[model samples]
Target chain A: MTQKTDQDYILEVRSGNVNAYAILVTKYKDMMFTLALRMVGNREDAEEIAQDTFVKAYTSLSTFKGTSKFSTWLYRIVYNTSLDYIKKKKRVILSEHIDEIHEASIGTMQDAMSYLEAQEKKETIERALLQLPEEERVLLTLFYFEELSLKEITEIVHISYENVKIKLHRSRKKLYHILKNVVEPIYLSHGSRK
Target chain B: MEAENKKLDQFTKEVIQDAGLSSPSVDFLANVMAEVSKEESLVKAQNPLITKVGWMIIASLFAVFTFVLTRFSLGFSILGDWDLSSLMIEKYEMNVDIPITYAYCFFFLLVFVIIQINFIKKYFYRSLKN
Candidate 1:
């Protein structure tokens, strides 16, 4: 049997088969939670935001005009919900000193150097991602991890295509800066003279 | 410096692409479904049919009261000078008058209708709060 599409589930929901909505919630929950996690930087807040997004989506499902993909519409809700949460928290995670980042294990400048020499590329990248600002992390996640088009991301983030492009470029630079902090030490420790 | 930066940027993009999506708690869908069910129940409880029926009954009783008052010709001065009776008679060409007992009954009915309206409004407002 063919899998039911999001539109099929949506039509069922509109016709009063509320149980069909559970399929949609199950399908999108992980993606929504990941986006929320990238935005809010915590599992608990991410879960709350994802749950709230699904509930809001269900309540407002009637207003969905089918002009866009259902995932896009649902994503817009999750993005706005996560942003509202961040605004309410009033503390942008990016404002912390690089050395004081919660996930950073480098206690001293010496430790940063020593840790960089020993860290794997994957772990280094993960730590570097956490070290960057929330916006950059979200942009990278959407563009690279989620593999969304620049236009789709523009719609979700409510920015112009040009603005998304520029911000994405800037975010790449920021990510590189964070990654370089960890990676450069490994090159020196390998006795590669620059 | 430029070459090193370019390489790091490439590596970062590859790592990001490989990071994969995060998973939520296993019960996430169940929790959402529970909330959706709760909301659906609240909306069902707020169905407007009961209030609509209440208004329809009130309107039918009002029509019957007016018809009886005009047909009986028991005129009362306090019930707006029998204007409703006169209008009905002139429009339909039937003799009628406003009645004192009907006036008292209509006054009490008006009070009851007002109270019913207030109660319905309160019911709606409370349902909205939920």
Candidate 2:
């Protein structure tokens, strides 16, 4: 496979170049995984959903017609796949284990006074992220991690852009609140520097 | 409201930059690529139209089978006994032993032909008529 542009890659894929699809899968897999992981909150399920998304995108490549950007189409598949998997798994209830992790991060942050502090901060953020409502978590993931614009998020999530904007606003507000209140206090109030 | 909007915008950027949501891991990509390859092979093995036609043929066959089964059971009850006087009376008053395979075939074929003709007429000849 000579390195090809996205359009060329799509064309090759449409023309029955099976190997070309590997390029696309490689390109989008991480973004898809993050999207799925945020939606379902489990790495294994997220990985499975990401794989399903790629397979589905390839099978429905003909229907794409290039109407939307390739990433948009890919995200739509990832979003829908994650949603379907969540429905099947019936894991809507946020588990206590997540809360336990969130609480433990606070305890561990007390003695962290150097390079490990940064790692702890990252873990704290991820833990707080798990506390958000499902829709809020998904919206934040798509908008922030996926770098999808509000309009693109609307298309992928199948909601109005105004609705996306409002939901995104509320989600961000909730996320900030969780970080500031739930995680930040724990870190800031940790025992005075040595 | 403007201040609130600015704060939200700032928060959005901060979150996006901090979250670090990149694409899947390298190993995950490998798994997805393998899955796509398998799917591609399956997709290439058959034409879309052929698959649709195949399903239609299968459904038609199933319908024919169910009709045959139903008719055979009905036949046993309607024409079980085999005697000369039974045949004579059945011939006149509709009570006799008939193999029923012929009737079942005739009924099903009639239905199949009618549906095919209707489909062809609607899809092919109707456009010509217009």
Candidate 3:
């Protein structure tokens, strides 16, 4: 069975088969949910935002002009939807001002990570990710996990490619700053043994 | 410095990929589909049964009929050559013949107004929520 493309399902939807949208929703739901969850940092509100994004996407599907890939367009919608939600709720995410790193050794960070159990690594990364500013979390996730190009992210985030590159760099630096702090104790313990 | 940054970037990428993406509740797909279906229905329902063009056509026909009725006069002009003012006066005179009290009439008018208001409110409630 050849899996239908996103465009195929979209055309079916445009032609009046409303149920065809279920396939597209199922296809993208995980990525959508994860991205929304990362943006909002709460499972319940993340689910709601994901739901609203799908509904908004369906309602305004006609406006899609095929100028970019469907997933890119959908990302743009979810991105804006999350922003609107944050603005409406008057959410104030306390930001830790991250300085540019002068010396944070990757070898020590790797040693600390290998020292921890698998579950601890997962929880530690997620916890630290949640603490970073909202936009950076989104930028890093889209850049690394989704492997979206700078041009695609530029379209979704409405920033120039140069800014996207700069932000992505800073986001990586910020995330490294957070993850390094979590394993700083392990590094110190290894130093005492030496 | 750039080479060091690249190594750190590669390390973060590996660790993040290892931790993996977060999954929503098991019912997330069903929930979003439910909302989508609901939104589809709302859009469908908002399409007025009588389109604006339809209403315009009906209004044009009605105006034509009203004008024809007003100009309607035969060689035999019964009811005073079909004079509209006289007919209106006769209708007013017929109102005087009714046995209803003015207070009852006012009360009934108020009740009908309240009912109409309630009907409009009921019709718009769902749309307002959307």
Candidate 1 lDDT over residue span A116-168, tens digit each: 42335445666677777777677888887777899988888898999888877
DockQ of 2: 0.23
lDDT of 2: 0.70
- Model 1 CA deviation exceeding 4 Å by range: A93-124, A184-194, B1-12, B50-130
Which of the numbered candidates is closest to the native, going by highest DockQ? Answer: 3
Residue lDDT tens for model 2, A63-144 = 9878778989898888888888878878765422212123333333323322235656666667677887666777887777
Q: Write the per-residue lDDT of candidate 3 for residues B18-88, one digit (tens) a residue.
A: 66777778887888788777777777766878999999999999999999778974556565656577556
Chain A only: TM-score per candidate = 0.78, 0.81, 0.90
Alpha-carbon RMSD to native, per candidate: 10.0, 13.8, 7.0
The lDDT per prediction is 0.76, 0.70, 0.83
What interface RMSD does each of the candidate structures achieve?
6.9, 6.5, 1.8
Tell me how far the alpha carbon of residue A163 in candidate 2 is from the true structure, in angstroms, after superposition: 1.4
1 against 2, candidate with superior TM-score: 1
| CAPRI grade of model 2 | incorrect
Q: Best-fitting candidate, measured by lDDT?
A: 3
Model 2 chain A worst lDDT run, 10 consecutive residues:
A95-104
